[model samples]
Target chain A: MSQADLSIPFRRRAGRAMEDAFLQEALTIATTKFIGLRREAFDAFPEGEGLRDRAREIKEATLQHLDRYLEQLIGNVERFGGRVHFATTAAEARAVILEIGRRAGARMAVKSKSMATEEIHLNEALEEAGIVPVETDLGEYIIQLAHERPSHIIAPAIHKTKGQIADLFGKELKRTVPADPEALTQLARGELREKFLQADLGITGANFAVADTGTVVLVTNEGNGRMVTSLPRVHVAVMGVEKVVPSMSDLMVFLAILAKSATGQKLSVYTTLVQGPRRAGELEGPEEFHLVLLDNGRVDQLAGPLREALYCLRCGACLNVCPVYRQIGGHAYGHTYPGPIGILLTAMLNGPASVKELAHASSLCGACADACPVRIDIPRMLIELRRQVDEKRIAPWIERVVFESFGWLLARPLLYGLAGRIARVLQRPFVRDGAIRSLPLFGDWTRTRDLPAVASRTFRERWNELERETPR
Target chain B: MTTRAEFMARIRAELGKTRGLPPATPARRPARPRVEAEAIRAELAERWPEALERFRHELEKVGGVFYRVATLAEVVPVVAGIARERAARRLVSWHAAELGGDLGPALTAQGLEPVAMPPGEVASAAERQRLRELVAAAELGLTGVDLAIAETGTLVLSSGAGRPRSTSLLPPYHIALFDRTALVESLAQAGVFLELWHADGAPGPRGAVISFITGPSRTADIELTLTRGVHGPKEVHAIFVEAPIRG
Candidate 1:
């Protein structure tokens, strides 16, 4: 589901995803493989633990003085003959890029995988303005052809099967290809190569921008980042303000652990460091370079509850390990980002009310925190978000009433015991197998899960009886 | 549109509201990057054989072909043999100034058509376009490595006056030549060299990009089935010359 399609409600979307057999198998295989790969990658590298801490420290440090680092980044980018633009909102970001494309007379823009651009829905705007935006990454290309959002961060089309992608390729290219991955990949390579050569504008998202050197770093496995930054006459990099690092030293710390967390590779196949526009004596590279610094709610989070989330590297490790994400998949989240971190990011970008339902999506398992390279304490922030949602009265009235009544009852000993006794008698008809499988007024809660029947005896009651029976 | 002043002001406001954040500092940068880089070089001088062995093993693990040769002259035969095996003849290479030594004549003598990129920027756009097309059509790309990271088996190549970014990128097969001089034990040590390159008043590569290539371009996007050469070279062969090519 698209961001605009959230009207369907997250619960129904999740239910639909759970019922899809193909998606179920796909999510299991894909997330399980990624979890194993990430584990193995870290297992082989003993020092990864220290580096993850260092990486976390660097992210926090940069955020503490984000203003200073951003200024340095802007100065150096301009010093290197690149232009810097400030965008405070997604629409503003889209406008800034659209104006750049307009001025450059760009007919086609080739883009690498970028959640920032995706968040802004840049492709639709570009197409509306008559500039063709081509997604160069194979997964992104497949999704773009299908008019779908990325279901996974690193593997955009993880929800897709080879047969489905072969069909996508066949539809887009007007030729049928086998369902083999290698054949499909070769066909996409041939298709995107032409776009790389012929496109007038190259757009990308910076994995990290070095403040001292004014370099925008892009790490990709398929080399599309390099192609996007190198091929076209005009290049624009849209990046969140949090992506800037203090120096090259800090960047290497992230580089050491980022790929390990995402994939098992020690480093991605290509780590392209783009300083600025092409220099005078260079034969290739864009002549004009532009870096768009995107705020779009990230600035508010410095003092907001989701501040630690700013340290997110956009690695999908959290998604792979998330129980909700593994079961329901990304589309159920109904936003640009999906999964545990995606919930916080969605809240960060859209606000607390946006994730009224998504906030309760997690089981608070803490696997995401362990898998997170930066250790952002996702569950802590998630609970915080849930509180904010409740405070704002954004939760459904039924949920608010139930939780508030429960809180009220728990605050008074006599009332709590009385309510428990009443609940035990009322829960008899719905009780089966020692659990409440359905309820007259709480079907929403029992639809996908079971509520433990008020135990045969309350814990407080049990404790009191045992004390009375014992000799004192 | 948010102006720079407004953007910075808002950031400063949010930063002002932040309370009791953990005390954390970024990674310590080298005080004198050039000095630290030289120290790393001297340290690696004795440890380079071990570093080289680790590099070879890691590179081969990533599906990259690793070869060790005595000098730059031997690089041509290896390139020719790779070409013969694939039935490829057309090759593109960096200029001799950037590559450390000329291999075009030797490669040509071995029945390969070698195109050396312009030593500096071409003044005419048409000529630049022609060069891009030439590199795109070439079957092989040959360039010299600026740094060979042993820990990750990565080849670091910076674009500059004589080094075009497309030489290693546009071709199907990439063969990079490096020596003991370019070997760095780990990414941390490579960081020192990178710091030196960007240090105040330091002379760095003139071009706009530096690429760290670990293996050929790969993806597991479709069915999570790993595929190589999705957009970049399919095969990467690194030739390690015992004698430093610059000398």
Candidate 2:
């Protein structure tokens, strides 16, 4: 779908996704496998639980004094001859990176998989400026060819079958290859290797930045992080302000648990720690280094209702466990981020008005909170967002009216009892097999689910009868 | 465009709005990193055999081949045998100083064409480009491990003079040689060594990058089917030298 597809109502978009049989089957298999792997990985390591709590505390501590750590980060990066730029918005971030590319005389840029770049839509901006942005990560490369957004955080192309991927590659390379993962991967390696060696600029997102050592850490299984940071003449890393940690000691605590939560590995294949541009005596590295600290709606949440969201590691563990996401997948969320945490993040990056429909997407089952490595209370914040939506009058008039009248009745016992008695009579015609299968005014809700019929006898009536019969 | 002052000021204002948050602190850094690192070294001196055993188990679990050689001299025969089995030639290795011994002549005597990287940076862009081509075309990459983490079967290599990052990347086969000195029991112990490197006035890594490689490069992106060597080495071989090469 193009950007115009976003104009469709979120409900309709989600409904369409539900109709896609391939997507449904793929989502079930992928998420189920990820959940099992994460469980097995954590089960083997007894220290994982304590490490998770420690990681959570470290995130909070760093955020509480974000200013000091950021300043230290800036100082250390500069001390090592790297330039730092501050971008308050996505547009500014794009402009800053474009300027860097222009200054470096870059013709083609190679990139590793980065949600920050996806959030800013950097590839389009780079293209407009006449710099070809090549995504080197295999999964991201497939999506870029298919002209689609990532459907999963760690595995971007899971929505695609090997046949579909082989077809996509055939379209790109103008030649047919066998529909096999190994063949497709080798072909991509060969194709992207030439780009890596020839690209003038390399772009990436930092998994975490060490404030004390001025190091930007990138975790990947494909080794593209190393290739991008090493082979190009100029390197640029864009990161959210929340990615900064205090020291290398703090960084190790996160590394211990990051891959386990994301891919169920003890550690990712490659954890590259880059301090700055090429240092003296280095044969191959970028001549210029730029670190862009992006604040695009993140700074507001430092004290806003979504403050805890800044603690997210972007592991996608919550997405796997979320019942809604498992059914609809990522693109149905109709934004850069998707899933339960994606709702809060979308609200953080956009606004509460942006997630008016998305706020109600969750079942509030608390499975997401349990699966979260940092133990973020996602359901609690989701309820807060729902309340915000209702208070702002963003919900439809019918919903507001129903909920408002329900609240009024709940506050008054006499009216509540009388209304229940009236509902029992009114519900008799619709009630069948003890369930109201359809309702005239609530067709949207009743179409997919059945509402329980009102009881034949009111609870208050039964309670009074019991009280009268009791000897006491 | 946002100035640093404006950006930081906005953050400061938001931070001020928070009140009565729970008390929290970051992980406690070692007070004296160098001393702590030495202490770890002293403790490992007696427990290295156990650490090495764990390293072998974890390494094999991740599909890596493990070999133990009594001395650095024996590394050549193992390398030759691996190359012979795979019918691979044209190997690239770190400079003799970085590898702790010169094996170029011995490897050449075994009928393999080995190229050692220059000890320092090549001044010209064209020369650097030529060197990169050689590394990229070589079938095997040979280098020394700075830290071999046993708990996770990870090899940590720092890029510097004679130790280019691509020595272990951009090749089909990667063979890393390490000694007892480079072994660490866990990531926490490696943390102490990392802290010691970046501590005040300490001589940290000579280059700007440190890579922790657990196994061969892999991806399960296509239908969740595991495939190795997408953009890095397909096979990783770690040879442990029972005698310290640095000595």
Query: Per model, how much of the real contact set is kept?
Result: 0.89, 0.84
Q: Which stretches in model 2 have alpha-carbon errors above 4 Å?
A: A1-4, A458-472, B201-203
RMSD values, in order shown = 1.3, 1.4
Residue pairs whose backbone atoms clash in candidate 1: none
lDDT of 1: 0.93
lDDT of 1 by residue, A1-472 (tens): 3322677878889888888899999999999999999999999999999999999999999999999999999999999899999999999999999999999999999999999999999999999999999999999999998899999888889888899888888888788789999999999999899999999999999899999899999999999998998899999999999999999999999999999999878999999999999998988899899999999999999998899999999989999999999998888899999999999999999999999999999999999999999998999999999999999999989889989988988899998899889989988988999999988777787987899899989999999999999997
Identify the CAPRI category of the predicted complex in candidate 1.
high
Clash number by candidate, in order? 0, 0
Error of 1 at A407 (Å): 0.4
Candidate 1 residue-pair clash tally: 0
RMSD of 1: 1.3
Tell me the tens digit of each residue's lDDT in model 2 across A18-79.
88899899999999999999999999999999999999999999999999999999989888
lDDT (0-100) at residue A285 of candidate 2?
92
